[model samples]
Target chain A: MASSKDVIHSKLWQEESEPGDPFTATACYCSGYDVYGELLHKASYVDYLYLLFRRERPLPHVARALEILTIALGNPGPRDPSVHAAMSAGVGGSPAAAALMAALAAGAGSSGGAREVLLAMEVWTRCGCDLNAWQTAIASPPVATRQLVWPDIDHFPGFSPYARDVSIPVRQTLEALADCLPDGCARWLLDHRQAIENLVGLSLAMPGVAAAALIDMGITPEAGEMLTLLLRLPGAAAHALEQGEMGFRRFPFFSLDISNDPGPAMPKEGTAR
Target chain B: MNERPPLETFEGSLNTTMGGCFPGERAVFRGHDLHAELSDSDWIDLYVFGITGRRHTPSQLKVLHAIWVNTSYPDPRLWNNRVAALAGSARSTGILGISAALATSEAAIYGRQIDIAIADFLVRARRAIESGRPLSEVVGEELRTRRSIGGYGRPVAKSAADERNAVVLAIAKKEDLVGGGYLKLAFEIEEFLLSGRWRMRMNYAAIAAALALDIGFSPREYYLYLLPAFLAGMPPCFIEASTRPEQATFPLRCSSLIYEGPARRAW
Candidate 1:
């Protein structure tokens, strides 16, 4: 079974700097999908490509976009699900992604229509994928090992559970985007940063601390400090902290003294040199 | 595409609903249902018949207006997309309902006039947005002009909330008494129309709009306004209203006294 980390890396880790056009980006994302082989990390990549293409055209092109998607997915890979830990989550082609691609392809005939396609592609892709989902997963801790399976061509599965389970890397990616995209098309990404992060963290299979680090980076340092505090709590509080279920707690992080060392002093009002 | 009904179907239906037409191809009248005549005064009546209480939100009313403007005239798809964009923005931003039906319904109304009217009603219920006057005031005033021709009375509520809820509740009750498959079908037709795609080798909206004009609004209005009410009654499941049941409550809301059925039996 492919792990979440492998899935994400396969779809998004290509070394290419920027996709020249919608077709190339889509092609890049589906670089690992092959009909006869095990499903590759094509989930996000294919989804990303559709997102790009969708910005440029109407949804009618989805069938065609998907055709291109399948073609690209069908071409690459050694096809071993075991090589990728990322393959653990969602194994299916995203319906929303397919819808987007079909809409794009249906608009202008699939040739020389890059400019319009590119313009439209920018609208949906500007925010990147929803990230809060990843973060939520990462802030959560691990449990028993289980068999991981990728979704088949027709169905995409394993989204919700994975999002709540994984935490770290997902948060990192979200932080990276929030840090980078705030001024442009990415502003929307921040709105659902929590959800996106939760999805990403789970999809990527990162540690809980990694998620905390990401939240710290994307939001405030104080939030990071609080998460760090939660990690040290005893019994269910600590467990809940690791699970990203800090909602039901009875006390504040400030009240708990996890570490034996004294914490950083609070800044006084109007301090001078 | 070459063999579509003329715009006259809509106009003719409007004429019949307002006055003479004994259940002809384009008219259906219930009682002295003068609601059709209100169109002459540039007013449209909203028949809400169900729940004793619920009301239409300002935003819902605003969205309705946008839907009506885009659907009521030619190029309903164009308006549908624009309204969908607006509605999508509001929904994604966490400002309104998060379900697909309302969004789909709002989007579907673009090319079809009755759908447009419902959307217009939604838009009208909103407090004045961007524009200075509230949409409800605008629609209500316009509706008043139709009162002499159509015979629609004002709701009993003095407050906006009371009036809006009365409308919503009325529509809900009517929908519960009758099945709401027609509204669902209308929603589907609108989606196909706004999609601007030709499917089954046909541009669905043109077909839908023509049919809408032929069957007209009185039937559609009752069906649409009552949709929310029906949905509330039933639990969630995929709705296959158009295909499963061959017989439908044609103009379920409107009476045969005003308009007729399809101009061509094909529909």
Candidate 2:
């Protein structure tokens, strides 16, 4: 066990210069393979992604689960804020990087995005793997009444506002994917599905399912958000490119009344400047 | 068995040390009671203190606030504001539209990052001048090596006679913040640059960055501090554009585009 002082001294302050060059290498090794030389041509994109994050190739079921989740959350339609932002930037003739950056920034808030997913993971960790405790905590009052509040627990990060039964598909997907995994958070989440539903009064959000699967695969919560963001980048880029081709088009809702008539200017209110 | 290290090994938290909950009863901020401090201190002071872990005098606070207020251009034609306007034109959500504009605000040439680079250069140049190097020599050396000074040129205007610059400088003068080393170095460099054939003039970025350095912020801190300088201007543009018809902002047709490629061919 480390003491407080020991931990303080050991706190990580990484120096990049001391290490041998990690960049500019001839070939990249990921998930126990020469990715540049071989895996790039042979492996599936999802498999490569799994390898990059986990540092080990995923099981068939795990890879399938990831594939499905990526597909499901890939677009979220142009109506989604991040995609809309990208499209908007593209419409304004911004570069691809600007569009993508705008999308990424838009996705960083407390809404159904990466930050919220990370918050959900934090809550899961704080609950000590106890589903009942997690549910009770989520159902608790706000910070003023409860004396303490977890970062985004009041909003319940992993629950969707659009639909209550969203968790059903997520639960089914996780169950199908759990065959190859060690019995841990992923299994726990699957096992306590009904109970979670009863307590939250809604199905688990896709982010919650993603958080569990990622945690079970030895991926950290922060890494989970990053991976999600990476998967969504292509979709953002595609939307942006489409918008660019559309020649500065606007969405339907942009048509609104622009009136200039103010109810008879109040006869020169004070002394005229 | 291995011997343990000493217990007095803890150093300090690096950046912020302002406020944290004390578990049960109350919160503490910068070694003062949060409630007590809130009642007595201005909110801007509290905000500055929160980021910097240091308090500012009333004059300093006024000048800092003025920096932000002066740069709030309501015109939607500006680059960042154009982004917000376009997002609104596309009927994007409020969060999406605003964040898109903020992200565009981080561009290399005319964004927050350039302010930091310019400030860093000014600080280094000031130190060099202090060590007996001529200001002209330093400016000449910098221009020769880097080709372009980060904060000197304005893309939109030919001259440096901007109302915004005048207003910000006036505030700085009023608050007695015009005599700092960085500010002096910035003016000297500007004078040298203006004498050259290019006739480059100091833009608002240079002035803002110099003032930021004069106020005792490090180059990195100045960059972060100036990140929200144009934030207030973005929302109005967004709101106004959103209220207009879709794609009303600079809409173009396919026929209007210059097609320089080979005559139309089938796939």
Candidate 3:
């Protein structure tokens, strides 16, 4: 065995010692920008978050666009599976951290979740400025090369099939986000929103809008996945706490039918015909 | 092809082959009564049943159980276990600590990622070999593509030094579970690797992945089934740390940190 177990810390961040104390941090820097000395007062939380991922500050309009999207995604509402999962954890009196985790796991799904945003952003990379490519990709999404951690999506990712029409929030976020970046992917999406919606016969949901906006801001699909997971967390956390207070009696529950009957013990070891 | 359903189909309420709970009454797991039918079943066997929808014979279950038992190195120094130990030291909850540790279970190096990669490689190598390609050529193709295979070499220890492989193999042999195609292929590839300039020994992952495939596990099934492979050892680390003073597990001074970041600078 090696005598020492030590590592050179991440180059992305570090802190300065106080004048007399070596243990405590006097200042901190992220990607070489003094977080407390410079960006703390000047940078918005959105800008700081952007720098953490992109390693650079966003332009003014881009920062605004991100903030707008962040607000819209902050709460996915009680009906959304992510928030509902957190609520379930809360009502069950699980550890505080479990609520957030439940939210993340449920929110990372391929349907109207962070995974959808990641997938949609990938589509943006391949089909930039091409409506025809979008149509083909949506009509028949390509298969994953092999088994993946998450199950394969059944419908076009990023769009909301649950919503029969383009919902109010989706339209509002799309239009406002487009104005922030007046000539990019978000703008293109907003301009041709109706046509894009028509192709799927379903509404372009928040993940779809978020995907286009994040891609327009030059964020990668992977980063978009993380961002969506994070931005949507506030709603899950808040709802979890509220549901915890309200208790399980008030919590929404579901019933399932494997069949009309309680099924026979799973065809015991080779008993199945 | 990945067949996707229409939007209309997804809009309907849930349709599941797997069973669910009825609040106060019964709960079903993969169509079996969780409390009644599976109450007496070994957890590992039921876990496999849950994933594969098939129950293993006694010998097969023994081999499968042995795989997990042998790999459960409770030593907190291991990457995934360290997270649990640290969480306990920090006075965190068991659920949070174990979940966090399990989150790190599929890390890029020395985790489920490698198992999945190696399993896929073995499956592909098997296909290529059955289609008349030599084992050596298939391995060479893998080397050319991925540069280094996951299950072949132990980066931390030489092949001769690693202890788990022999023990697990011994258990499998006793159970008569060692003669499967993938296991034979694993040993054959190890021999090929040893004779060549790359003198890599078959590690636990190679053995386990092969055994899983031999036991009728698809690559996906192996991955899912082994999600909590390290779960047994995590709680002990957590419990051990909880007995000590807060933040006492492997406590280090501030000076111990090796910060190679930028030097102090003003705003």
The model with the greatest TM-score is 3
Better candidate number, 2 or 3, judged by TM-score: 3
Clashing pairs in 3: none
Compared with the true structure, all predictions reach lDDT values of: 0.28, 0.68, 0.83
Give the Å error, residue A18, model 3: 4.1
As for DockQ, the candidate ahead, 1 or 2, is 2
TM-score to native of every candidate shown:
0.19, 0.49, 0.86
Model 1 residue runs over 4 Å out of place are: A1-175, A178-273, B1-104, B110-225, B229-267
Query: For residue A209, what is the lDDT in candidate 2?
Result: 73
Per-residue lDDT of model 2, residues B22-117, tens digit only? 344455576556764555888667767766777888898898899889888877888888888988898886666777787678766777767766
DockQ of each: 0.01, 0.02, 0.33
Write model 1 residue lDDT over A66-148, tens digit each, in one string: 33323322211212111111111112222232222222222211111221122213222322343443344334422211100
lDDT of 1 at B109: 24
- Position B216, candidate 1: lDDT: 26
